[model samples]
Target chain A: GAGVSQSPSNKVTEKGKDVELRCDPISGHTALYWYRQSLGQGLEFLIYFQGNSAPDKSGLPSDRFSAERTGGSVSTLTIQRTQQEDSAVYLCASSNAGGSTQQYFGPGTRLTVT
Target chain B: EDKVVQSPLSLVVHEGDTVTLNCSYEVTNFRSLLWYKQEKKAPTFLFMLTSSGIEKKSGRLSSILDKKELFSILNITATQTGDSAIYLCAVLFSNTGKLIFGQGTTLQVKP
Candidate 1:
């Protein structure tokens, strides 16, 4: 089976622009997650979706960060007014359930905000 | 606030040497701890520890968790050049599915 996958492996955008990153979770996975890794920093949790509903969005940094999942399979993370500090690798992961199983990761989308 | 910390931000070792990576965390309702090896964009899962004082082993890698101490250690025995990569430690709490990750430890195993 195909593992978790994300689109736009690399993206470079000017600051103040908006960017939408897409993610396709594994088949039959009910839980999806979004995280970002900044330069010289660890992975930071952004948001999590259980089915089509988002139950835990506390990790979102600010109002510019928002994520939505459709049909409980695909998700999109939108960053509004991207800032230079937003440059990082956005990773997507999925699991069978909320937090009981091991989550599989995707190759990630590296966003460079210039 | 929940936080995870790893020691020895970077390490250099030769092949056949043994290395130990440490992770300590502070979180509410801690459920389990996980270890991952990241060489590229994707991070591969290594182990998940839920019980304290129990060691999980696979190949040359082994990890043990200490709930009382709020820390865990990942030991790689007979390390090879292929072992060079960034090791990440994350803690999963009972509240949500979000994982709190530590600043990874970069290991360099020279041949």
Candidate 2:
């Protein structure tokens, strides 16, 4: 596609339930990133994948949050045992070379854990 | 501690008015500073500044970064109602390839 794309624009799940947010980065983009936007907090980085290098999961808030990039094209963010504090917008961005370049963002998925 | 900080958390301006948003960060490994305009869903890329003193402009929007000062400013001239949105600032850390973002500045351009 022309730009990054995400699925399930809106999600409402009960506490302790699991949810998966998907992201399809732009073609040939080598760097993909996941971030979350909350009411007061800024866009907090969650994880990133660059080429075949080990993903930088240092930003992940907890062990329940995990992300995987398949074939270096598409990515999925899985949140297990969702909590109400987890309600926020999950955004995905892709850059051409790495984080140094401009990133294209996808319409985020608004996840509401009730 | 927030590595990135933005000023004037929210602002209201009338059409044709110009506004300047501020962002400052404390990162030694900063690779670049980026600006984004976000509406209801996602953010749209605006500009990326890598060097100091050079300004990047797009239409009525312009941004300049000062690496030595560890700060940046985004200027929006001749603002329109359509320009109402949240403006975000982020600094990319080269070492970890992680971006530290600031609490956005919400601008409301009224007609």
| Chain A TM per candidate, in order of listing | 0.96, 0.96
The sequence of per-residue lDDT tens digits that candidate 2 reaches over residues A77-109 is: 999999999999999999888866888889999
Worst 10 residues of 1 chain A by lDDT: A50-59
TM-scores for all candidates?
0.98, 0.96
User: Candidate 2: lDDT of A96?
Assistant: 89
Chain B: TM-scores of all predictions: 0.98, 0.96
C-alpha lDDT values of all predictions: 0.94, 0.92
Model 1 ranges off by over 4 Å: none
* Per-candidate DockQ vs. reference: 0.88, 0.79
lDDT of 1 by residue, B3-28 (tens): 99998899999999999999999999
**Model number with the top TM-score:** 1
List of clashing residue pairs for candidate 2 = none
Candidate 2 residue-wise lDDT at A5: 92
| Model 2 share of native interface contacts | 0.88
